[model samples]
Target: MNDIDDFAQAYVLHRRPFRETSALVALWVENLGLVRAVIKGVAGQSKSAILRNAWLQPFQLIRVQIRGTRDLKTIYKFEPVPTGVVIKGEPLFACTYINELLLFTLNKHEPELHFFSYYQEFLKRITDIFRPDTEIEPALRQKQMIIELRCFEQYLLEAIGYSFDWGSARDENIEVNMAYGFEPGEGFFPQASGLYQGALLIAIAQGQWQTKGALGAARAALRQQLEWVLGRSLHAPSSQGKLMRPENG
Candidate 1:
């Protein structure tokens, strides 16, 4: 176990009060996958007022100085990276959902720069959607956000090595017109009750979300795949689950 004293970019995934004057924080670092650290004296009167501020909020990009060994680190410095992005209402719930996914999916001390970049892009897209100058109808905006969430979920799976190929399945080419069932830890196979459409799978593979019913299809497919990969169903409590539900959106 080596001590790391360098600064790195990170986003707060979750935080909870520890003792009386400190907090335990889960941070997603650029080169470090997921890091758990204790921020000393943030909850009480201390000089590290920056840690007590909104900069520690989830999805707020920031640079942090981490110290100590692999099991648990201590955050000595926290600085905000402002993007002027504000997430509220349904979008906020969507953010929470993604954060939960990361908390469950990522492991400690692993480096995943690609996943980090995708996460940054996801936040930027959210910021763009809610920008004051952009004109988008409520219904349309909601649809777009859902698609965005699906896209992010797909990328997250890929990053963690749970990706599925849409063009080919188990070393065989997928017929564009055929319906197939998805087998976890294996590729697709033809089945009468298969829930995935070839064209829809292709669209998801190609990152195309504008097609009719594509959003719903992507959501269902990804959720099924993720549950299989994680070995448990995603339990998003009724409230957060409703935000990501296509029918509710």
Candidate 2:
């Protein structure tokens, strides 16, 4: 246990006041999926930059070193990922939303490295948009962002042991042409009759661009199921299960 302590990385996910001068923080480290640590005297200490308003933005990877304590551990050291890029605008906020979800849903000291890595990669993809020379058009960029977000949502649902099947129904080996609603236990079913739609599944399987409308419809179906699975811990409750709106202009 002592040796393993030296290998942990530091991450600052969320923080709140623990007392008048101290703060409790949620950190996601490489070795530890989520850790609750207290920043002693953060509100009152002049040298508490690491606690008050440090560089621990979500999605920006950092290397952390911590020493375990009887109560709250000490954050020994930390630094930004050398190759990290700053994400701007609504995307950045969306990233924060994801971090909040992880912090809220995950158990402390639990090692969910796969989910952490998925988050790291997602951040990298968004950071690409901030690159100086990328020439992706604004409309195309929005489309790409939506597609990526949808994919991430699916990934999150699956990773958390939720059942979500996008399979479509078909007759005579031909695609089933209809929209379906997603249910937590029942999967995807036709709009009114609770029947499965095979054609939508086929379209998703084929990765056809024409299926954007279908995919959008399917996403709406899944939202209902996901909401139940996510429960009351959903972030940005005012958004109410809707995808964060893309920036205009």
Candidate 3:
């Protein structure tokens, strides 16, 4: 059993007020997966209160020391990661959507270092999209953002053992330009009335995003796959309007 006295690198996924002077936080730690902890005295007028207030926001990377024996641990310290990425606009809502997914998908106490790294890289890519030095056109930028979200969703599903093969194992001569239907628990099958284009399925299987309509195809495919894993529709109410708006319009 890992001791609660040690400090771990983590990112805040979500937080809410627990009582009058404390708050409950969900943290995605480097080696400990998602943890729910109680931050004591954060709402009080103590000297460390201001620091806690600044460091406890969602998506801020921090090093924390927690102590407790029960399911809910008590945070002892907060050390913010310098040079942490700051997100705004549509990316901010996208971040929230991913956070909600993590909260719902991850099991407490299971260490998923690969998924943790995938999350870090995902944030880095989102930050890069908004960088002043980058010169992406507005339409392409929106498409790239959607691609990033879909890629992360795929990674998340695979990490938790819910991944389905994107290619048909029985068909070795499958054409990359034909239409195919995706059956849950089975791979893609060639069909004249299939909903997904062969080029799109191939692109998703290979993680290629340079082709036209790749992003839109990935969005539809991932949405269906994620819905199957979640057993319900994946709804991001806060960003539904913005997400549904056409990128090229």
| For every candidate, C-alpha RMSD to the true structure in Å | 3.3, 4.7, 3.6
* Candidate 3 Cα deviation (angstroms), residue 248: 11
Off by over 4 Å in 3: 44-47, 108-111, 169-173, 236-249
Off by over 4 Å in 1: 45-51, 108-111, 236-249
Per-residue CA lDDT of candidate 2, range 7-87, in tens?
A: 455556677777676667778877556666765555654666545445555555667666674446666555666556567
**Model 1 lDDT per residue over 18-128, tens place:** 888778988888876788899876665565654555678888888888888767788888788887767776688777777777776774223246888888888888877
C-alpha lDDT values of all predictions? 0.74, 0.58, 0.72
TM-score of 1: 0.86
Best by TM-score: 1
How high a TM-score does candidate 3 get?
0.84
Candidate 1: Cα lDDT at 30: 85
Worst 10 residues of 2 by lDDT: 240-249
